[model samples]
Target: MRRVLHVTDCYSTGVGRAVDTIVGLSPEHEHHLLWAGEDDPAGKGFASTTALPGSSLARLRAVRAAVRATGADIVHAHSSRAGVYARAVPAGAPVVYQPHAYKLLDPRLPRAARTAVAAVERALGGRTDRVVVLSEQEARLAARLSPGAGRTVLPNVPSLASPGVRAPQPDGPRRRRVVMSGRVSPQKDPGWLAETAERLRERDPAVEVRWLGSADDPELTARLERAGVSVSGWLPADALVAELTAAGVYLHSAAYEGFPISVLDAAWCDAPVLAREIPAFAGTGLLTVADPAAAADRVLEVLAGGAVRERALQGARDLLREMNPQVQRQRLAEIYA
Candidate 1:
């Protein structure tokens, strides 16, 4: 069986979920994780899991040591930070790097910083055997950044539970909640959400805006609260399911992403989706909005429950088939071959 050694700095949030999905994609292969996060990914079924040293230099040294000790057939790095670690270290095995979302593409970064990040990626490109991407747009981006690395377009599957038909809420005016799930960060562009929530509230006081994840940024949290957007800080599984079940729409506002697992979960839960326009979502069948203003209008249209909502819901349903484990299993086997 092929053995994959995964290197990652993020194993607490979305990246961790992505790793879980990857492990399940190819059951015939054994997986090992060398991670920097404090919490171990319980139930991930790794052959072995190691925590990296605290410092950056130490982390790199630890990766080099792990590469030799594991005798891995493939070194798969998750995210850009670990991409640096895995590709910088000499691995006797082939290296497969998945940036999750390229840091260089983040709009918040200064042009000069983005350029520097691109240069680092180009310098390390030769060490990468393949770059795993979730979409064709990402594949083309990888081709430009990692010229020497081959591209592997692996369909992204949801790692979260489906939650089936939404639990019926108490009979009322029908909760008009637009929900966004994820920690408050620049990537999520809480500013856009704040504006959208305010505009939505002005249009209809009955409309509600809620976030399914934590309020990690104090400033953004304040803005969201001011805009009448409620934050459900890291809800329990049952509570999350309840919220998603009653959700009129799931809004994804990431300025950039590797195609989020939350979107997949939202669709699986059967909530109509409204995401911001970004390259990662191009041709994904999901309806994307140009701006928060447009998003507010779309959310209202979706909540109205008509052809627009049905069409929006249908897109996500159709896309779910691409993420079936069996489909991914076949692709993984072919790519690693």
Candidate 2:
């Protein structure tokens, strides 16, 4: 059996699901995953995964040991930290790095740190076999940073099954639901989302907002609660998908992204989108907006009538078929083999 090792700092449910699909199709491929700090329950059966010590050095050492033990032919790493650690593993295995979003996009990262990462990519990229990206925009960015390596587009993999949904319309005139899901850091900018929701509420008092994400900011959570937005941190996959399907409209309030799995989830659930006009988010037939207030207006307009919702749902369904996880895995098999 050909062995592969996937390394990442943390395991997202989306990532776990994708890995599961890959393993299902190509059982001949023995896959092992390693991450830092703690094991993710969602990652079970995706591969035999190990959670290493928190320190970078310790994590790298553990990954190296896994590489040796697995006799891996390819090392696939996700995120910047994992990419660096994958590179540190012995050169016997071909290395492939998948950066969901480049480390430079992190708002908390220092400018110097960003520059240093770029320099390191430039230096080590030649030794790397391929850099896989979830969007064409990310592929372009990777090419610019590591001109010596091959940049391959391997778009995000979303589930094929429809998200079962249910909801109660709150007691009000314009009872509509708006949903946003992601990590609640500055990149996601929950403040902007709250502001957008406030504007929507002005036009329609019954407009309700829900956000599902890792709550990185306690102050933001308090502020959102004050503004009447329901915030839930790290929901299970089934519950999260149900919420996406129940939402009258899904909002993509991110500043930047390679290709957000949440947007794909919304599409899979036949949910309409009022999304920021980012290059990666193009072609989803969403109500694109530059202004947050205008975004709010668009969302309200789409949710006001059942006919509009029906039309939007059809569009979302079309997009969902185009990006199905099974088809995406077939594509990856071609790339990997």
Best by lDDT: 1
Q: In candidate 1, list every pair of residues with a backbone clash.
A: none
Off by over 4 Å in 2: 37-43, 89-91, 105-113, 159-175, 306-311
Taking the tens digit of each residue's C-alpha lDDT, what string does model 1 give over 307-333? 989888988888798865667777788
Candidate 2 residue 63 Cα shift, in angstroms, is 2.1
How many clashes in each candidate?
0, 0
Pairs of residues clashing in candidate 2: none
- 47 Cα displacement, candidate 1 (Å): 1.5
| Number of residue pairs clashing in candidate 2, backbone atoms closer than 3 angstroms, sequence gap of 3 or more or interchain | 0
Positional deviation of residue 252's Cα in model 1 after best superposition, in angstroms: 0.8
Candidate 2 lDDT tens digits, 1-337: 6788888776664554455555555666778878653235453454576776778788768777888878888888887778888776554588888877786655567889889978987776776788988777778788887777777777675543423333322233323789998767677778878888888878888888999876768887777777788888878667776677678888888877777778777777667766777777777665577777778877877887666666666666666666676667676786578
Name the TM-score of candidate 1.
0.93
Cα deviation of 253, candidate 2, in Å: 1.1
Give the residue spans of candidate 1 off by over 4 A.
Answer: 161-174
